[model samples]
Target: MIDLITAGLDWPVVVALLLTSCAASFITAAFGIGGGGVMLAVLASLLPPLAIIPVHGVVQLGSNAGRSVLFLRYMRWELFWPFAIGSVIGVAVGGMTVVQLDPGWLQIAVGAFILWTVFGKTPGIFKRSGPVAGAFSSFLTMFIGGTGPFVAAYVKAQDLERHSHVATQAVLMTLQHGLKSLMFGFLGFAFSEWAGFIAALIVAGFVGTWLGKHMLARINEKRFKLALNAILTVLSLRLIWSGVRLVFGI
Candidate 1:
């Protein structure tokens, strides 16, 4: 992996990757959903398939950790335990069964679900049921890579304050990604093989998150939601397309 990255075949590609990491991290810090999904899509296209999920997990772990630290005080502690428990159960099932599933079909389903939400016709399912929402969303996250928007949609419907919203999402994401990283490790994903690149991406995410913290303070909550929804819609389309290509071998 390092050899491919360092072959000097094209410095522009490296620059683009770094830029994508920064943009995605900043979006994640500010909005809580775009970073991981965007980064995963771009990196999946560039890197080996074996490296995609683990590498994305590590980078997102750093990004969410930074967000959690910056907004620690605003986190809703009451929500953590149930959500964490559900996430653990969900990720375990997802990790164990994910390989048996067709990636293309999974992507299409996820993409369709996201689009349904973006269209504003989906009725609120989690607003009145916190535990159920936490458990199911966390489970879907294990297979989907990033489910922040679903969680955010629930929180929004409940009218959570901006700080609590960001903070709560950060906490949930941190738990999910941490568990994912551990699972990947046990499965022999070879973190050491991409240590240098992963380390660089983490540092880049850290810097992006730091900058995002400042911007988050100044941005209006409504505007942030609008931007997040827009980007997520775009990401959903891209993921769907990628899945189609993979499945059809076109």
Candidate 2:
């Protein structure tokens, strides 16, 4: 039973992963962004190199799916369809032409994109950024893993209410992570090796999302928005630094 739960990992890593999953879930549920990238960074440092992105995809799928289910009432289905359609097309292409890219270059591109999205002041862009953002994110995510910040940046530009923001973003991430997980499975990534750990993470994430809802109610809109932007900025900077180190082989 202990072997099953650890899935070849040490007990300490399993505990750390579970705790991070719960905390990351709370961040996403309460702030509607940042958690996925932060979780990916954490997992990257812990998991086997080849397994990082695919496993992260599955874990995030469960995490975001739980959040979406909890906030189902506020989901914006009308906007979701167009974005999902674009995502399907993008993912299809990604699935066909898949190759392991230079992780450094991928991080560089993602960081630059996130900074641009956060600091850019183009009102007209948000009006139609959904499909474009969806397509871009879905394709990139196939190669580099967590591009949730890109999608979140676009969603932030949409000016959604707090609850709607969390629900809608959760749904969108669910679609992306679901597609990525399917792609990984189809490509012969052995998810069974980590089944016990992933299941535990999902259960923890659900509880975290539930707890986060209570805190979400107390956070005012202004502070919530500020936190979202701040998280994006910090994550963007981290990505850039990681990219630079990898590119320089430092």
lDDT per prediction?
Answer: 0.73, 0.86
Residue by residue across 75-155, what tens digits does model 1's lDDT show? Answer: 988878877777777777777864566768777776777777676665665556666666666556555565666666555
Model 1 off-target regions past 4 Å? 1-15, 121-124, 129-144, 244-250
Q: Which candidate tops lDDT?
A: 2
Which 10-residue window in model 2 sums to the lowest lDDT?
121-130
Please state the error at residue 86 of candidate 1 in Å.
0.8
Q: Model 2, 1-250: lDDT tens per residue?
A: 7776788998889989889988999888888787788789889899999899888999899999989888999998887988898798778878888465787988888888778877887456655767877887898898878788888887887788999999999999999999988988998999998888889988888888898888899999999999888998898888888888999988
Looking at model 2, residue 60 earns an lDDT score of 93
